[model samples]
Target: MKRIGKWKDRLAAYVDGTSGEKLDQGVICRDDQCTLGKWIYGEGLAQTGNLPTFHQVKAKHAEFHVNAGQVVEAVQSGHQDNAHKMLHEGSFAKSSRDV
Candidate 1:
């Protein structure tokens, strides 16, 4: 969760013009690439797939990535304000909590 929070912070920095790290929408769109995602798809699924909440976690995790990618798309399109807003209180923020 801390790593995931840092990922969002990196995007926020990019959108704020404070960091030079290049944002990649394509990469952010792949939820399964993150550590949490890896566990969800691998050990987590194997260990807890039968749990009722497992499916919800999986779905929310996927949505979080989609929301994150949308924020990156806004940034890449020259919409820093929109991206920042998203990082704070829009789809991105919602997913951050949901996930």
Candidate 2:
């Protein structure tokens, strides 16, 4: 969650033209690479795999990564306006909320 907030900060800054943080889409695209993601696919999966909601959470998390990566691409491609929309009201925002 905190990591997501950090991403929000970076993207927000980029949209505002106040920062130039280089986000790695390669890293962002991997759902199992981040801390929360690692847990969700590792110990969390081991313990909660039997629960009906567990898979839902995992799927949402993966979707979040995909959407996040797209936002990163938009930012890196000089499409700040589109990136802002993706970050605020599109699939990226929806996936973040779902996760």
Candidate 3:
């Protein structure tokens, strides 16, 4: 399996230079699990707030970091087109009921 560290690296690059910033991928906190796809934080998830979908982890170049609020705003912005694409292409929104 791929390590979270590697994933974080990719996420950092994706977020650093892509439209993912306008897509509400959220942040990748120190929690064990992820907030947008799966909450492995041991405690649970970081409540998705008023947003309609989970958070996303992205990267652009160096290393992946967290972009919490921005992602949520993307979901709230009513861009279901991009949201659907991201969700479909990611493990974050695999289930129809997830997002």
Candidate 4:
């Protein structure tokens, strides 16, 4: 089993709406949990203040990260097409260098 770390735990909490802490009205603090929380919430400008609901965050996190993991695995296993398809479906814009 994968050993979940503190960041992952916090991310799980945020994603599940179980964090019990109100969303910070300002930028997420630079603490460890906040740093990871921001990532799991998806990167953005701090001033935008347009945050998604817990359910949306959780679903997108799972979709992107899980598909990204599959893409990495496929590339490592010599399945370039599979990786490309995953990236395309995930709406990740591939630069010329990435091709």
lDDT of 2 by residue, 1-99 (tens): 777778677767866678867678998889999888889989998999899899898899899899889888887888878989998999888987787
lDDT of 4: 0.41
Which candidate comes out best when scored by TM-score?
1
Query: TM-scores of all models?
Result: 0.92, 0.86, 0.24, 0.39
| Highest-scoring model, lDDT | 1
lDDT of candidates 1 onward, in order: 0.90, 0.85, 0.35, 0.41
Clashes of each: 0, 0, 22, 0
Indicate whether candidate 3 or candidate 4 has the larger TM-score.
4
Model 2: residues >4 Å from true position, as ranges?
none
Ranking by TM-score: 1, 2, 4, 3
TM-score computed on alpha carbons, candidate 3 = 0.24
Q: In model 3, which runs have C-alpha deviations exceeding 4 angstroms?
A: 1-71, 90-99
Better of 1 and 2 by TM-score: 1
Instruction: Give the per-residue lDDT digits (tens) of candidate 3, residues 51-75.
Output: 3332332221112223222223345
